[model samples]
Target: MKIATILGTRPEIIKMAPIIDEISKRNIDQIVLHTGQHYDEEMSDTFFRDLDIRTPDYNIQVGSGTHGKQTGLMMKGIEKVLLDEKPDIVLVQGDTNAVLAGALVASKLHIAIGHVEAGLRSFDMTMPEEINRRAADVCSTMYFIPTAESAINLLAEGYSRKNLFITGNTVVDACFRHLKIAKKRGIKEKSLKELNIDKMDNILTLTMHRAENVDVKERVVGIIEALKELDDADIIFPIHPRTKNTLEKFGLFDELNNLEHVHIIKPLGYLDFLLLTSASTLILTDSGGLQEEAITLSVPSLTLRYNTERPETVTAGGNILVGSDREAIVSNARKILDNKNFADKMKNAINPYGQGDSAKLTVDAIEDYHARGLLDIVAPEDIMNSFKRKMKNIREDISVKDFERKENALVHMVFDGKNMQFPTDELNLNGMVINYDKRE
Candidate 1:
């Protein structure tokens, strides 16, 4: 089956790279659609080159704008592309306008949709990403949840039990792959030394790109004030162009004007950022990807947003939710600094994000879902076994007859965010299996 993968932002592009790579190795036809949500040629091109992903088969050129306008433009442009491509499924990753647009178009066009990074909820509705994720989740044919927590979130939303797959987070998968490649070539270590920083120093990595944080004067000031707390610490901020523009517009540029130590530089490519994250002491950000990346890198973070859809990071102890409140941000930072036990707990905490193989797991889930439909590869007994393994975390006995003709085949896997739900009431959550199919 042909899969058209849609991506618009830098993080989505990075996360999708591994899935695209996995899919191609299987000899499946893959179409890459770039919505141009991010317009920086230097930043965008670096991802394709550094990550070794193919250039887009189609470019929509739907550059930046208000949320409604960008989403609308993507919807129109992506809809036209879908009409021309007519692929079996559309894949989208993370929560971005491109994902919502691609999923909406595919759903309206009667094509199946697969959402990577599905079922993340911050319970805060003000953020556009939360809205985009909710919309995509409602429409997806397959939900590739990055964590068991995310899958639980989907089940709470009343999604289908059959469609949800608790695949590990693809970001971790992609990050580890690039880091591994870099280490194999002796590049990861070199990349860190180039930055004039060591892994031992206390570091606070920061990233902010959302319009809500950048476009408004209050939010911008709040961010600047919090960032100022790191004036004494080694604060590394690889900033996006939009964040720079917002800073300039709000007169927040003077905060870093001729500053000696606050390293505010152009955005780093996927591999460079991964290396930086790997060596950093802590993270401070508004970006969802950074929140997840903190967990992947085993670093602690303080989210600048008041509410988050990805609560797993906080519960996993990888991050703290400080939002934009200036005093609160400063106090929280100080508290975390003084609390060595808390810091060690986070540093040594289990990586709730996923191990390094999430991309492969996500690919396997999509392949199985498709194979079961087309070839009847999963018989009743196999289905029971699969369900037992997925829900109970226990291996179930499968009769030989169940797999007499079943064969796992090579398949291309792409990650996308579109609405897809799988509902299971039997799954025990926190010792309470109360009916959760209606809460999402």
Candidate 2:
């Protein structure tokens, strides 16, 4: 059967690489679609080249726009591509606007939709990503859940239990693969050295892409200052396009333009980021996927964002929820730097997400689901159990919060560009409150 993979943005490209690679190895009929969420060549093209993955089957060139506009463009564009390719199923990774768009088009066209990294919920609907993921899950025919916990999440949401596969995370698979390849080829970590990092250095990596962090003056300033504080260690930053623009706008461009300590660089390709991350000491970011990835790799992370969907990462002690607190960023970082015991504990912790072969398991499950002719199925018990376990885990170790609607109010949590400041206990959401609840 023909499988179409949809992706946009750098993270999607990295996560989708393994799936794409596997499909090619099997000589399966695979088609790739680039949603062009961020059209910069550095971010998008570099990932494909760095991973040694093939050029996209089609580049839609959708570019960045308003959330609704971007999603709409992708939906319309992907529908046409699906009609042209007419694949058995359209596969998408993570919870980007592209995923939502591709899922929407495929669902409407009566084509099967497979969602990778399914069943993740931060329990915060305020995030566009959470909205995109939930919508995609509701529409998917097959779920490539990265962890057993993710499959349980689908079950509680009342999605089809049988279709959920406990695939090892493709990201981890890609991470290990790329690091090996990059090292074997002697693709020197020269850029890292350019930051004056020594061999076996403990690097703290940072990436900021979201508009919220870049949309304002103070927030942007706060981020640069935060980076400035990360001294005596290499702070390798792979900046996103919008983030690059924001940094330039705030006139901190020259300060970090080529600063000695803070290595301000453009986004790296798949293998580069993977190798860089694999060798790093700690990750400081607001990325959900990276948070899970850090856990699997056993690298301690200090989240730049206030909250996260993958509270399990924090509860397991591989991650810290700092939420843009300045004092917290510097202080906690020092604590982590000084504490050898904490580093060892988090490094060996279980990767609650998955073992890194989710694509294979998911494809097998999809074939089985189709063979059963049970396309119109939703399995609630499976997801409910997973959610319960996660909630139970959160309750035991972390503080849990529930949100109730304040009439006509838009909910938002402010982040001041601090490092791992907030306690993970604060992010242990007992459960999620979505616009609609679906069940089997």
Among these predicted structures, which one has the highest TM-score? 1
Residues 1-440 of candidate 1: C-alpha lDDT, one tens digit per residue: 77899989877887888889888888788799999978876446655876678888888888889988999999999889889888877899878888889888888887888999999987778767788899999878888887766886776666654577777788787777778765554434343456677544667677877777778889778767776765666777777777788788877886765465577766665666776778777777887887887888788788887778778788877788887888877776766566788777887767776787777776777777666663122224543334211121113432222221232211111111233222233321222212211111
RMSD after Cα superposition, model 1: 8.3
- What TM-score against the true fold does each predicted structure earn? 0.78, 0.77
TM-score of 1: 0.78
lDDT per residue for candidate 2 within 197-310, as digits (tens), equals 447476888877766666766766766676677777778888876787777877877887666867777666555576677778888888787887788778888887777777
Global CA lDDT of candidate 1, please? 0.72
List clash counts for every candidate, in order.
Answer: 27, 20
* Full-model lDDT for every candidate: 0.72, 0.72
Candidate 2 global CA lDDT score:
0.72
Off by over 4 Å in 1: 43-46, 66-69, 181-195, 215-231, 248-251, 335-339, 374-440
Off by over 4 Å in 2: 43-49, 186-193, 216-230, 247-260, 375-440
| lDDT, candidate 2, at 235 | 80
Q: Cα RMSD to native, each candidate?
A: 8.3, 9.8
